[model samples]
Target: MVVEKNAPLQPCNTFGIAARAQTLVRVRSVDDLLAVLADPELAPAPKFVLGGGSNIILTGDVKPVVLKMEIKGLRLVEETPKAWIVEAGAGEVWHDAVAWTLAHGYPGLENLALIPGTVGASPVQNIGAYGVELQDRFESLDAIDLATGQSFSLDAAQCGFGYRDSVFKHAPSEAQDGSGLPRGMGLAGRAVITHVRFRLPKPWKPVLGYLDLERRRAEAGVEHPSAEQIFDWICDIRRAKLPDPAVVGNAGSFFKNPTVSPDQCADIIAREPKIVHYPMPDGSIKLAAGWLIDACGWKGKSIGKAGVYEKQALVLVNRGRGAESVTGGEVMTLAKAIQTSVYERFGIRLEPEPVVV
Candidate 1:
């Protein structure tokens, strides 16, 4: 079990915020995690499981012991006439895994192309893009309970998946339930995902329902496009709208699109007249968060060292580089200001997508 103290974290997080971990452990495998749990000196300490660091904001030095997930593997676990069961290590780069599946002739993950973070974090946030979501293809996931060191497997139902939410994002309650894999039981900070399996259906269907994707398809003049084509197009679309973290640091889409009742949506529409909203299957209206932020005039605006991306107001970025980079404080301050403005104008509270710690 290798452990390092006062480890640098600027390179770990996509935000490029300067921060450090009080104690960091590189968990390359399940054995490494078990070893830490078995150690008397480390076992009792509080811990934080970190994956690709693509969806988090570091306010300052992390006090809890950091378990940097680095486990790696990718393979076809099983295949049936109906679907292909592919498994990936929790630490695997999500985009690379998506490309690998397409390269191996599996195609369902193409719509999720260019999404940042690891396989483990995908389920945690129920990451979605275009017209597809991780939960749509999730087969099951294996995780170890950090408190009890018990290994368990959960299907999509047990994950309690919602829009940008899951059991992993909730807080555990000792009195929530007393059973096996019950929904609504929180697992945040209590478990570590080690491997994730996806079930891609045998018959591949292109999800071109999204306006942007549909427009791209129409512009291309291709009646039937392959999965690879969709992947390349999504990558291109994201690149045009978002700033690469390696260049201008950001946690992609800092706010989740807020949902509202039809009446509420109508009220906002009556006022703004140009609010971007879509009717959900559940009869609710999902408003475009970027549109709201842009309406509030946040795009390209800076506060301290944090700024909203010029192309997409939903994303708050670190304008400074290296030592002069934006702190989490500045980012949250900007986010709060945006939230306040949007709420004051629209009567809807916007929720941030990234986890803050």
Candidate 2:
């Protein structure tokens, strides 16, 4: 494992923020990770596992040893009459992996196309789009324990999938005896996901429950759309709605769509009749975060070099370029302003989606 000191980080993250890693190691394979752990100089150091860097906001120069996961491989692990199992390395680009699966005739992952980040980070965030989530297609994943340097595997249940959350999002809690055994469910910084496997069911069926997909189907004049058609529609819709990170530096959605109880929804609706919301399967009301921000007059507004996207109020963008780029503090200030305004107006708190490092 080659360790580089003060490695440049701007190119790694989707936000294009300027930052540096104190010590960075590019993990091209599992052996490289093991080697790093075995080394006396690096073994005890706190580490950060970085994938595609799409879902993170670098607050400043990272102090932890950055394990830049660059492992790359994709293959069909198994095929049965009921399903097809495909595996990908941690570093495989999530969008490319979805497209690869579809190209190989695996249809279940088409709904998740164009999501940023890597396969390794998908489960951690429970990344979803359209009407499907990563949990719906996830089979299992392999990870190495950073603390113990031991590799392990887990299924969906063990991952503890939730809306935009998973075990990886929480810190490990203390055991009753304080022996470091995690209580309840939280993996967080304890593990590094090395690979992910997806289970695509046989006899593919399209998931077109989302409004945009339905509208696309209507516009195309097709009663039943193929997987490829749905894929194309999703890509087109996302491209039109969200800015390409390559052109404009920003994470896709800045905040989660806050959910409220039925009574809470009624109360909010009584106050603001035009508030946008959707009924979830669990009987909760999911509020549109963008609507809340826009209602607060944040759209197209700027604070220093951080600005709210004019097209979609849900996204926050960097108004500056390169060296003049928006700092993490500016982004957080804008985010906090929006959150406080939304909470004061709607009596609901908005949570950020990206991990701030």
For each candidate, what is the lDDT? 0.93, 0.91
lDDT by residue for model 1 (1-357), tens: 679999999999999999999999999999999999998988999999889899999999999999999999999999899899999999999999999999999899999999999998999999999879899999999999887787889999999999999999898876634443333669998889999999999898888888888899999999899999999999999999999988999999999999999999998888889899999989999999999999999999999999999999999999999889999999999999999999898888999999999
RMSD of candidate 1 to the truth, in angstroms, is 1.4
Summed over model 1, clashes come to: 0
Report residue 62 deviation for candidate 2 (angstroms): 0.6
Q: Would you estimate the TM-scores of all the predictions?
A: 0.97, 0.97
Q: How does model 1 fare in lDDT?
A: 0.93
Q: Candidate 1's error at 336, in angstroms? A: 0.3
Shift of residue 60 alpha carbon in model 1, Å: 0.8
Q: Among all windows of ten consecutive residues in candidate 1, which has the lowest summed lDDT?
A: 174-183
Task: Report the C-alpha displacement of residue 321, candidate 2, in angstroms.
Answer: 0.7
